[model samples]
Target: MQETVLFVDDEKSYLAYTTSIFENKGLRILTASSAMEALEIIDQEHVSVVVSDNEMPGMRGLELLAKIKELSPHTVKIMMTGSADLSTALAAINSGEVFRFVVKPWKKSEMLRAVKDGIRRHRILQSLAREDEYILHSLAQTIELKDASTRGHCDRVATLALKIAAELHISVDRQREIKYGSWLHDCGKIGVPEAILNAERALTPKEFDVIKKHTIWGCDVVRKANLSKTVQDIVLYHHERWDGKGYPCGLKGEDTPLEAQIVAVADVCDALTMDRPYRKGLCRDEFLRTIVEMQGTNLAPHLVDTLLQILERD
Candidate 1:
């Protein structure tokens, strides 16, 4: 998506020249005369690679790069400086912020090569992210096989959560996190015993306590896998309730991340509508009434409302 490269420099002439040099190289070019302006572009646009001149009016290139890292950690950052001091290069490297450091009055070939390398690195990261997503989906399916009753539960929850996220106008990156998190939300069930999961009888208090540990277990699994913080939160907090009475952490209301909240609604809806070992599945009208009754207590009111609208539409 970041087929665009952003050039940041105080010198308008320099930005124009850089754009001209790269215009025909099959790259979309974006420019800004100040770091603040560049930040605006970065926020508003999908910038794959950023090349910034070190000495800008307000914010230095290194400082701008740091902010950009927070805003879009995957965007490749390249620093250019005419001074090209040893300390500056060391600082950029030490901060782990720069993909490439170029001396000012750059050769055309050298600059082109660095930009190409940055683009290549960005594409590699994108590919790796896709692979990670595939692995997460497979893991979810494997976890489902542990309990026959919940065979397609993860996929259903993911589909419903994604629809809710889209209706809420969540960003694409966050939507991806929601999808991954939904699939992996129940992964901690792997730690539970088969007899307990498959038991047709209602769980005793002690057994229910064991069930609560699944959230923490899921969080541990996600942590060891080095997943994103959003995914970890979902794995741990998807059981949290709006009224602060839920399990594992009992996080209440907005304290739970919005993504987790969205997944929670999906989980509840799916569980209510699907047959469990002990109970019959609810019909569509009953499921809708149950979801509406949960608003402001068991579920986030806005999310419950969004889910109801989605159900009605479908």
Candidate 2:
């Protein structure tokens, strides 16, 4: 699909001339005469770039740019103004957060170059977002490898969570969140000492307390990294229980984010069914029975049902 660009200006001649310059670029161009009209177009179209004149009738260029940033943060913003004042340029850069600024009486070539650069910057931001997600997944795998008994555990939980999310009919974006949450659910273990983590025997009170710190530690790690609120919530609350008996925050019932709760159930199921260094894996029937028993007490009841259905289909 051709990328859509929204150009906002109150001047009819300027709008016509500017629109004509990019008409042959194969872009879906939308023009608005006012800031309010521009906002309406943005709401109605998938605008990838927003170009606004610095001086408009109702709303100044900077004001319209700020509103565009608020409405569509991912869209690249460009400010075009007749004023060449230093303060105006600085305010446009700082307040509007424009990707490019073009002065009025712009050469067609310069304006075109600015638009091209804005598109390039937008692509770079998207690539960076993907890289961030890749790095987070790589770290999750590293966390899983820290414990021999839990090797590949995170991957399995993530897979199961995605399946459960599908059964629950979540949006594709939400399913991605569930997958990331499941993979990083145990990331807090990075802060725990290896001895306690790999201990053959049961943990003492102090060791158990230290182990429990992983949830909070993971939450802090993700928070500091500035991950999306949904992913951060999952990492923080994956250890919480339905009966209010689990983990750092003790968030019970619906207080726990639904994606986190789903991950918790998947993680427990995988842990029970997979063989560990210290114990053999449970038989399928026994595993199913155990999870069924924990439904309302330990796991979210709806998620538990979905999980069993997933297993049945498999």
Candidate 3:
């Protein structure tokens, strides 16, 4: 489908002129006479760009731009106004989050150029978001590979967390976040020394302290890398316990992000059921019983029940 652009202006002549210009360029254009009408059009259309005149009767152009930012944050916004005053430009920049500002009596070529640049910037933002997610997943895998015993642990935990998310009927976007969070849940371990990580025996007090630093380290790494806040929180707090006795920050109970808590239960269940260098894997019955016994104490009660139901059906 062709990318759609929405042009909003109280002036019918200007709307007609700009719509014709963009249409000739093989772009799909939707027009609205007022900000309210424009919002309605936006709700019904997949608008990639919004060009709005600043001097409308009901809602001024700057106010319309602010509303657009709230309604469709990803849509590129361009403000067109007769006034080139400092205040108008500042409002467009600060409040409207305008991608470009066009003065009234804009040359057709100038208008076209601004639209093209807005589209390019939107695409660049999208590409950067994808690249950020890729880097996060790569870092997660690297941390998983640090210990031979947990080579596929991240993958398994992510898969299990996604299943639980489905059972809970989470939104598709939230489920995706949970899945990514699960993959990178243990990334803080990258900060722990290899000697402490790979040690076969129970960890010494100092070594354990070093291991615990991984959670803080992981949060710092993500914060520095500018990962999404939700993913960063999950990585930092996945080690927290339901009873409040666990981990680098010792966050407990409902203080943990729900996604992190779900992953924590899945992570522990998988770790217990799968073979580890220190011990043989538990039998299926024992594994199920162990989780059931810990419900409401170690695991979130609802998630524990969901996990057990999954295992039962399988």
User: Candidate 3: TM-score?
Assistant: 0.67
**lDDT of each model, Cα atoms only?**
0.88, 0.82, 0.80
Residue 267, candidate 1: how far off, in angstroms? Answer: 1.3
Whichever of 1 and 3 has more TM-score, that candidate is: 1
Off by over 4 Å in 3: 1-122
Q: Give one digit per residue, the lDDT tens place, for model 3 in 1-314.
A: 57678888988999889988886676788889999998877655557788998888989878888776654556799988776464776665775478788888889999999888887777776677688678767877888788888888888998888888888866454565677778887888877887777777788998888877777887787778755666777888888888888886777789888878988888988899887766878998898888888887788888899998887787
Q: If scored against the real structure, what TM-score would every candidate get?
A: 0.83, 0.67, 0.67
Candidate 2 lDDT, 1-314, residue by residue in tens: 68778888888887899889998898888899999999877655557788888777778878888776644556799988776554786776775478778888788998889888887877786678689779988998898777888988888998889988878766555676677778788899999998888887778999999988888898888878866567778888888899999987888899998888988988899989988766778999999899999998889998898888888989
Q: How close is candidate 1 to the true structure, as a TM-score?
A: 0.83
**Over 4 Å off, model 1:** 7-18, 30-47, 50-74, 79-98, 102-111
lDDT by residue for model 1 over 1-314, one digit each (tens)? 42989999998888888998997788999999999998888766668899999888889988999888755657899998876475786778776889887887888888899999999999997889888878889999999998999999999999999999889877565677788899999999999998889999999999988889999999999989977788899999999999999977888889999989999999999999999998989998898888889999999999988988887798
* Model 2 alpha-carbon miss at residue 238, Å: 0.3
Q: Is candidate 1 or candidate 2 better by lDDT?
A: 1
Per-residue lDDT value at 292 in model 3: 82
